[model samples]
Target: MESVRVPLGERSYDILIGSGTLKDIGRHLKGTAFWRDSSARTAIVSNPTVYKLYGDTVYESMAEAGFEPVKVIVPDGEEYKTLLWAEHILGKLLSAKLDRSSFIVALGGGVIGDMAGFAASTYMRGIRFVQAPTTLLAQVDSSVGGKTGVNHPLGKNMIGAFWQPSLVWIDTATLGTLPKKEFIAGMAEVIKYGIIRDSEFFEFIGKNKKDILNLNSKALTRIIKRSCEIKAEVVSKDERESGLRAILNCGHTVGHAIETVTGYTRYLHGEAVAIGMHMEAHFADMPQKEVARIKRLIESYGLSTGLPKDIDEGALMAAMEIDKKALRGELRFVLPETIGSVKVLPVKKDRVLKALKRGG
Candidate 1:
């Protein structure tokens, strides 16, 4: 097992990574502050698909460690990621009689992590939560950054809070069960880390694409750990995203706009981000070769790098205008200056329109 630390002083936490860590969750949680209580309570938030596969394992593990665990299942889809679903999670949490002293265990993919963490953040004015992210996207990005929220009709993650997890326990074994499309979709965020922060990591991925596609254990462990490390380093410094953290939104600005315009169902998060990065890279001042390299990498993952032919340009612009990073109605884009470097700046509307057209 290997671990990475997100150093936030009093709120700092560790991300534990290893194969089969999920089975030992109880043993791990036993060392945390929450375990001090003899009658500790926790809600295991998951979706039906994930719960059916791993629910009993988590339940028995927590119970064995003396935690009173309750199952809280939500439907498994992006369309369900909303305030109403968040409310549904809250209602289940209340029914479970979870209190501020109680912590949440988000036990599925990105949607579950977001929903559970959002619920934990709002329940009784905030409580502790642990992330046991199953999917690759959740493991690499969503699970670690403490950016928890449900989507609004107008935008992705429109309503949420930056609620850090007490611990992020990632069991890589879960990836063995991920569907191929979602796995490929996850490569977008992993690729983003390389583009915006580490050129070497980006090269490493390109060279090892075959092994990564085959799910070689060593390759998987390396990429997953490195991805977590880069994210942890960034998040630890700018926990609230007031400054440097915005760079983490590399493809998210246009990526989210795609999601919002498509009603959150057409493309998986990473798929949309891949297309977004390909299109928005045009707004950057990077060399043409660098831009093509970015597009090629995204495409090599078997992901799309262009807009839908039927997409409405006007709606896409309106969606981008309302992105969380927008300033005074102008969208702030995190554009790559080169691989391993990026800038968060506002692109002009005409330029954005051009990029949209280019994407088409």
Candidate 2:
């Protein structure tokens, strides 16, 4: 087992990563300051499909640790990640009469984690929550950062809060049950960490792509640990995305636009991100060799490298205008400087439109 600490002063928490750690969730929760509070309570927010898969084990773990958790299940899908679902979950918490001392345990993928965390942040002002991310995308990205929100019709993650989790429990064994495309989607974020900050890690991913695809325990554990560590380090320095954290949204600017234009029903978040990274790299005039390397890496993992031919370029540009990172009227993109470095540049609308029109 390995752990990374997100040092956010009072909001600090440990992200525990390992195989088969789900069974130990109870013990781990007990070690936190939240557990020390005698009035503490925990409610798990998950989807029906995921709840059927591993909810019993998680519930038992919490029960053994003295938390009589409320099992609040939400409908599954990116389309369902809306204020409506958040309100529904909040209704459950209210029905249970949970207090600030209580924390919500998000036990599914990014959708559940985002909604549950959002609900926690808004319910009766604010409360803590635990992120038990079940998907690779959530485990490596969403679960570590405090950014929580549901998708808006105009933009993705537009309505959210910077509510940190009390603890991030990552059990890699859960990946064993993840679908093939979903696993590949998660790789986009893993590669994003490499592109935005760690060139060596990018090369490492290329070298071990086979092992990672095959779910080799050592490879999966190593990548997830490294990804979390990178995110933890970034979040620690800029918990509220005041400055350095914007780089974390390397492909998200274009990626979220794609997701929104497609109505959140098309590509998975990471798949859209894979394409977004390639698109942004193209727009930034990155080296051909470097861009090719990134594309090869993405395609090799069975992910897309560009937007679908049918997507409306005009709509994509429109969606991006409403991006959370956009300041004033400019669209700021986190463009690659090299294999391991990036800069946030506010490019003109015409340039981005041309890039989208170029299409992959």
Candidate 3:
């Protein structure tokens, strides 16, 4: 297994990545001092679709380790990630008679992890939570980082907290169950890591797109581990995103806007991000050749670089204006300086609108 540490003082945690790690979670967590007591309860929060498939196995394994496993099954989809859904899970924790000593096991994709992590962060003023990310998007991106939140009707993840998980467990084997479109969506964020931090990694992805899409074990393992490493290094320096962590949002500003405009139904998170990256690249100051290269690379992966068919440029711009990264009414974007280098730039409304049109 490849491991990366997110250093956040006392809140720091380790991220473990490899195939079949899920089966060993019991061993990995066995005999911990925190669970030495007999009263510690562990709650596994997931959606129905995921829980029906893998929850019993996980629950049985953890139960063998002596921790009472409780299940909180949430409804699937981005629409379910709301304060109401979080409250429902929180109510479950309350009904379970959980205390600060108890643990939360987020055992699904990004939505499950985010809602569960948020519940853990707020329940009893905060408790330990473990991330068992099942999707490629969750395993390589959201699962490792501590950022947790639900979307508001106004925007995506507009309401969230910087609550880190105690540990992140990624089982690459889980990717086998993911649909082709979902797998492709994840490649968007994986590609983002390379675009913003490692030119060589970017080149590698450009070369191995086929193997990656095919779920080749070696290629998937390398991408997930490397992506986690980059995220860990960044979060270690800026856990609260006061500075360096902004680089992680390379395509998120416009991406989030796209999600909101489409009512979170048109595209998956990474698909929206893929389109966002293309538009951001157009706004970049790089030479036309570099811009074309980035576009081609994204397209080669079967990702979309064009705006949604029915989205209006004006509405998209309006959403971007209220993005969290905006400061004093000026929009800030993480734009590429080169394949491996990115910096946050404050862009004007007119310029952003122009880029949106170019993307359209």
Candidate 4:
């Protein structure tokens, strides 16, 4: 198993990544010292889809470790991430009689982790939660950063809190059962890490495309570990997105707008971000050739670098204006200066509209 430590002083935690780590989850939690007394109950917050797949193994493991555990299942899909669902989870935790001492284990992908962590943050003021991310997108990105929230009608992640998890439990074996579309969508995030910080890592991904896609064990481990490391380093410096952390929003500005305008149905999170990255690159001073390289990598992952024709450009622009990344109605894009480099600058609405048209 490979572990990456997210250093947030007292709130610091380890991201444990391995092939069969899920089976020993209870023991891992106990080792954390906080969970040493397993008499306290745990709520495994998951969706119907993910719980159906690995629920038994996780529940049995916690039970073996002497934890009083119950499954709190949420409906599956990005659409289900909302304040209403968060309320449902809080109700379940209350029904289980979970106090601040109890743990909330988020046992699915990004959406589950976000909603479950949101509940853990708001319940009893604040509590502990574990992020056992199942999908590649979750493992490499959302599971690490402590950005927990649900979508609002007007924007994505509009209502949320910054609550770090006690543990980010990742088992690479789960990727084997992920559908091809989901797996392909996840590569966009893995690719984002390389674009934002490690040029050699970016080149490494380009060279090892086949093995990575084929689910070769070494390739998966390498990408997942490196991505976690980059995010940990960033989160350690700026835990609350005051300045340096905003760089992590490379494709998120436009990406979130895409998700919001489409009502979370058309494009997957990674897919939208892939297109955002491609379009946002042009807003930077980078050479056209560098932009092409970014586009090629996105395509190799079976993602599009262009906006869908069905989407209304004006509505999409309106969504961006309301995005969290925007500054008082002004557009701000984390535009790439080059591969492995980016800068966040306020963009004119005209520039954004031009980019949108170009994307089509």
Candidate 5:
């Protein structure tokens, strides 16, 4: 197993990446300060589907380790990521008699991880939480980052915190059950890392797309580890997204707007990101060769580079106006300067509308 440290001083944690870490979570947690205290309780927060599959195993493992665990299952889907769901989790933590010393285990996809992490962050001002991310999207991206929150009616992940995780357990074995579409969605973020910082990784992904799609263990492990390393480096340098971290939002600014406009049902996060990348590329100042390379890589992963056929261009542009990245009523975009390089540009409203039209 390979471990990457997030380096947040008192709030720092390690990300464990491997194929069977889930089965040995007890051993993994045994060494952490959060678990060393015998009096600490743990709540395993997950969704129904994951609970049916691996929840019991996790619970049993913790029980065998002499830790009392309470299980809380949230309904699946992005729509369920709300204040109501967070309140429900808070209620469960209270009913379980959890205190500040207790820890939360988010054992599912990004939605569960985000909500559970948020619960841990707000419970009594801040408790401890671990991430047991199961899906490719979670493992390669969301699971490692400290950003946690739920969706609001106005936007995606609008109400959130920068609370770091106590530990991140990435078990590649769980990804075997992930549907092809979900797996493809994750490739969007993986590709984002290459676009923003690593040209060689981009070429590697382009060459090994088939093996990656097939879920080759070695390939998946390398991708996950590398992606985490890249993200960790970025987050470590810019914890609160004051500068360099903004590059990570290469596709997220417009992507989140897409999710909000569609009510989170029309496209998955990475799907919207895929479209966002395509549109951002059009506005980039990169060489034509690099632009073509990005386009080819995105298409190679079976992701759509176009907007949804039914989405209205005008509404989409209006949505962009409200994006969190906007400043002084000016649209800010993370656009590529070249493969492995990007910059945040303040785009004019007219230019944004034009980009929306092109994307649509």
Candidate 6:
């Protein structure tokens, strides 16, 4: 087991990574300040699918540890990540008569974490929560950063809050049950950490691609720990994404557009990000050799590096305009300058259109 700390002063938390950590989640949450003084109550927010797999274990463990646990199951899918679902979770919280002292446990993937965290943040002007992310995408990225929210039709993660969590417990054992396509999608964010700031980690992934895909325990632990460290470091410096943190959205600008234009159902978040990185690199005129290398790496993980053939160029362009990174309605992309470095630059919409046409 390994732990990385997000040093946010009063809001600081630890991300615990290991193979069997889920079995200890009850004890871990009990150790928090929130659970120290009373019979701590927690609502385990999960999708029906995930709950079916690990619900009993989580509930039994919490009960044995003397904490009250409630199950709140939402439907599984990106389409359900909406205010409507968030309100549903809020209703559950209210029905339970959970007080401001109670915290929520987001026990599923990114969707559950985002919506549940958003609910906790807005409930009674903000409450505490813990993230027990079950998916790779959520484990390495969404669960650690404290950026929580549901999606908007205009863009992904459009309506959200910067509420930090009290703890982030990641059990690598959960990945063993992930579908192949979802696993491949997660590699996109892992690849982003390498492209944005860690060249050495990029090479490490290239060297161990086989072990990673094979689900070698050592390889999985190494990648998850390193990814969390990089994210924790970045978030500690820029907690609210005021400046340096924007770089973390390396592939997300075009990626979110792809998701919105495709109605958030066709491609997984990681898959859309893979294609986004490819198109944005092309638009930024990154080195051809590097671009090819990125595409090959992404393909090696069973992810696509190109836009959907039926994508609407007009809608794609329109989505980019509303991206959170845009400045004065201009498109701004996090362009890679080398293997380990990227810069944010604003480009013309027409130029982006030309790049999209070429990609098509």
Q: What total of clashing residue pairs does each candidate reach?
A: 0, 0, 0, 0, 0, 0
Residue-level lDDT of model 1, residues 121-194, one tens digit each, is 99999998999999999999999989999988865678999999988988888888999999999999999999
Give per-residue CA lDDT, model 3, range 91-147, as digits (tens): 998998988788889999999999899998899898889999999999988987688
Across 1-360, the per-residue lDDT of candidate 2 in tens digits comes to 888999989998988888888888977777666676734457889999899999999999988988878899999888799999999999989998898788888999999999999999999899888899999999999988799999888656789999999889889989999999999999999999999989999999999988999899889989999999999998899888889999999988889888878877788889999999999988786788998999998888989897778899988888888888889999899999898999999898888888789895
lDDT of candidate 6 over 1-360, digit per residue (tens): 799999999999999888877778887666766567643667889998899887788888887788888789899988789988999999998888778888888999999999999999998898889898999999899999898999877556789899998888888888889887888899999999998999899889889999999888889989999999999999999998898999899989999999878877888889999999888888776788988887887788888887766887899989888888988988999999887789999988888998898772
Per-residue lDDT tens digits of candidate 4, residues 243-272? 889888888888888887887788888899
- List the candidates' TM-scores in order: 0.93, 0.93, 0.94, 0.94, 0.95, 0.94
Q: Rate the local accuracy (lDDT) of all candidates.
A: 0.88, 0.89, 0.87, 0.89, 0.87, 0.87
How many times do residue backbones clash in model 2?
A: 0
Clash list (residue pairs), candidate 1: none
How much is 137 displaced in model 5, in angstroms? Answer: 1.5
lDDT of 1: 0.88
- Model 3 bad stretches (over 4 Å): 31-38
lDDT value for model 3: 0.87
Off by over 4 Å in 6: 31-34, 152-156
- TM-score, candidate number 1: 0.93
TM-score of 5: 0.95
Question: Pairs clashing in candidate 6?
Answer: none
The ten-residue window of minimal lDDT in model 2 covers 32-41
- Residue ranges of candidate 5 with Cα displaced over 4 Å: 32-34, 38-40
Instruction: Work out how many backbone clashes candidate 6 has.
Output: 0
Residue 22 shift from truth in candidate 4, angstroms: 0.8
Worst 10-residue lDDT window for candidate 5 reads 31-40
* Model 3 vs. true fold: TM: 0.94
